[model samples]
Target: MGRTIFLLISVVLVAYYVYIPLPDAIEEPWTIGRKAAIVKIGTDLASFGELLGISHFMETMQLLMKFQEVPPTSDENVTVMETNFNSIPVRIYIPKRKSMTRRRGLFYIHGGGWCLGSAALLTYDTLSRWTAHKLDAVVVSTDYGLAPKHHFPRQFEDVYRSLRWFLQEDVLEKYGVDPKRVGVSGDSSGGNLAAAVTQQLIQDPDVKIKLKVQALIYPALQALDTNVPSYQEGSHFPMLTRSLMVRFWSEYFTTDQGLEKAMLLNEHVPMESSHLLQFVNWSSLLPERYKKSHIYKNPTPGSSELAQKYPGFIDVKACPLLANDNILRQLPLTYIITCQYDVLRDDGLMYVKRLQNVGVHVTHHHIEDGFHGAFAFPGLRLSERMQNQYLSWLIKNL
Candidate 1:
């Protein structure tokens, strides 16, 4: 029995090793090395989970994150304080120098596929502090609930509540901030929250101060279309795999483990929401540059059962990519960054066109050799330059 079990495990490992979905076209030596290193460490970690009989992906991922260090909590130029926005936890950063003109206020949400992460200086804290000091602005970083425990619209609500607190309170005067220059921004999953809050705020008449702009750094905008070209292209890339992304969303949206795999084929979108697909169709809506030789499938029928079951997906407040023209037309100026090697590239690219079509101004920067998590990744030279460029755009716009 022991030998039989060992043989079975061996066969499974060999199969996974032989057919691991890898990017077949990368030719650059450094990129190949970087991808190889990522794949190696990732393979070891994943294999470790399987060996231990750990079946839940989120728990496995949380274990894998133990390899990273927790960065220092303080910044010399900016004073940091922990506070709550309503009942939700938030950490605020204020620059030391008082601005002659009221400074801009930025709300930042940290990204971790909505499973695990914090508002610490390590994960996404560096850029927020840099922005506060560089732009001389007040920065509020939020702490939202993790998955399998807290789900969709929960994190969205936390972010929205923080946004409302910023809008309703005289935070601008309190922090010497300019009400006209405030904006929200986030990276990855945080980008997802930031964009959703931007759309949700459009109809809030009681909102005392309107956000002037939205900055999305490689955000995952919608769960409706997983088969988009970028999904296929970056499907097997380093760091984020197509299957892993499905697991991420499933962990956040539905506890129905059986439905997770089906949803990757976009089973979550209901047939009734067919009318909404026109707004999010990547094939026709994306720019020619984003188009690869690809096959496009009209969302299969019966997709709406999940929509009918969950319902948060069809709502514009949760998925900004499907927001109506009434909301899109009124959105603040936007800044978006897309990475060539990221699975969600086309999502942001398509949103750029969506905002532009509705007469909203957009500042888009595409990193040709960059990957999805480059904003928080310190090693990549292109990402570093892109981060500086992003902060520069914020300075000019504010």
Candidate 2:
């Protein structure tokens, strides 16, 4: 009788905990599904759900494995190559169809918030090949160095170097790709790189390379404000969150001093610089329509002591979207994808508005039923519909 009573009490405790409400921001249906999926996958791997915590490391691995099966398409041919850009690794995919004419070439970048991803990551590899097959284009996926160890300018430099090397090698001529049809593409962090690279190319007076377009998928274009409506609404979305994002920026800056600087948004940017206005023009850049559900609150002033402790946070390179109008206007025709349930959705939207304001051609797509990291699991049974929707949009735009 004593043992029976003990077991009943334990059962009641477990039931109570299970029925407790999650935090308001985390209560979205898609968020719940994402969290549950991570927990389920983690439990299967390690026999404990706690391993599925929402840190950058865990989330990165979860995204890597979300799509377990990727059907190989016969119409696409893939080859791995070593490149001259600091010996950076690259994978090239070309459509198998026989044609006499040169095709378009897309340089694809994989996303992992700049710290924990590779071009060889299954999702990106599959998508790269799929794009080649669907669009009859050549796709070159680059493997850039990660952050924390390599940090800020290194990631940007490596990507730029790879692009320069590709052009110098007469890649367009060797691969049967038209020089006029070359473009850049990436999702999330990769998207940010794509935008930055395009800007850099357009501004370079010596480089005569011409880019046809840039495709940014759920790109985190700006790091200036953490209070955007999408950030607040989807802060706890699985695979991404406000806190984890803070951590990524911290790691990417690569200095213990960088942390304090990042929080205050001043590590590399001086408060007196005119560039600061880019982050503050909320009314014009962010549409009032999207801000309807968001409560605009002024940022709390940082403690002087904390600002002095870390100075890397204010660097514009750390947050590329903070770049000046001179650079922004040089971007090519852009294709941007924004997901309604993603924390970074507003980042893409804001960029679209900024580019349009500068007279740059922009094409934007919004996925209403999508959540953060939806494209990573295109082949999964439960997420195929959303995944295909994303890929279809990409194919049509490409």
Candidate 3:
């Protein structure tokens, strides 16, 4: 009986690994082996837990990602403080310089599909610390609550609240931050939040401080038209597959896992809101270089049924790419990063087109050899380059 049980376990494990085969087309060759192996293992274990009805795949993956987080350590160039702003947890990094004038400020948001990652993670902590140390700026990293537990608007609200508190006159004065030179930046889902918050701030009457710049690193900008060229070519790549991405989008708004499959089909948009598709029509918006050979197909009319069931899928809050032209025009100097091997590449491209059309100054960087979450892997040459480019832009702008 014991031998039979052991064999059963072995068979299940074998089947599990077989189900999630690593993609042969690895775009980032520098760390292909380690990247592919980690993605495959994490995907398999998360899926295995769900298959066994032990825990939801989202939670399992979140736990696995959080497992790698290291505790904060003392830094010679920066002083780190872990605290809360308006009940929202945040990590504040202050440079150790004795400057006569107020320093620039940045609100850095970490990305993990809105369900994973935190300011406490070493990747984000290091990013914030260096930005404060090297740029001689003040950086506030938000530790917003994860989804599948907290749900949509909650994460955005947490970020908004943290920003509102950080932007207050007393708060800026206490930290010696230059209110006029403050900027916001984030990656992946955090980029979505950064963009959303930046837009919302444009029309905010109560907030007197204006943002100077925004840097979005390979951000996921739209839920509509996952059929874009980049999605077609890079959806199967490791670290962040199209399936995992859509799942994150769905889980962020609702508990319904059923919404994911339909979302991937581009059926989440409501029929009444079909007009918004023109804003996201990549076939018309994307440049010839990005279009390549893939023919654009207008997405099928969205299902009213799905829209009613999952309304947040079509929300502008979820898709910053869908914001109005007026809002895009008032946006600050923007720096957007796009990776050739990332599903989010076209999202950034389309946004650049929209922003430029509206006369918003934009500095766009398209990394031909980069992938989604390239900044997540610190110490890697690719990651360092991305980080350096981001900081350089801030130094020049702020």
Quick one: RMSD of model 2?
A: 5.4
The 0-to-1 C-alpha lDDT of every candidate, in the order given, reads: 0.78, 0.67, 0.85
What candidate 3 gets wrong by more than 4 Å, as runs, is 1-30
- Return model 3's CA RMSD, one decimal: 3.1
> Which portions of model 1 show Cα errors greater than 4 Å?
1-55, 63-72
Clashes in predicted model 3:
0
As for lDDT, the candidate ahead, 2 or 3, is 3
Q: Which is better, 2 or 3, measured by TM-score?
A: 3
- Which one wins on TM-score? 3
User: Candidates sorted by TM-score, descending order?
Assistant: 3, 1, 2
Highest lDDT model number: 3
Report model 2's TM-score to 2 decimal places.
Answer: 0.78
Model 3 misses residue 82 by how many Å? Answer: 0.8
Q: Which stretches of candidate 2 lie over 4 Å from their true place?
A: 1-36, 39-86, 255-270, 273-277, 301-313, 380-398
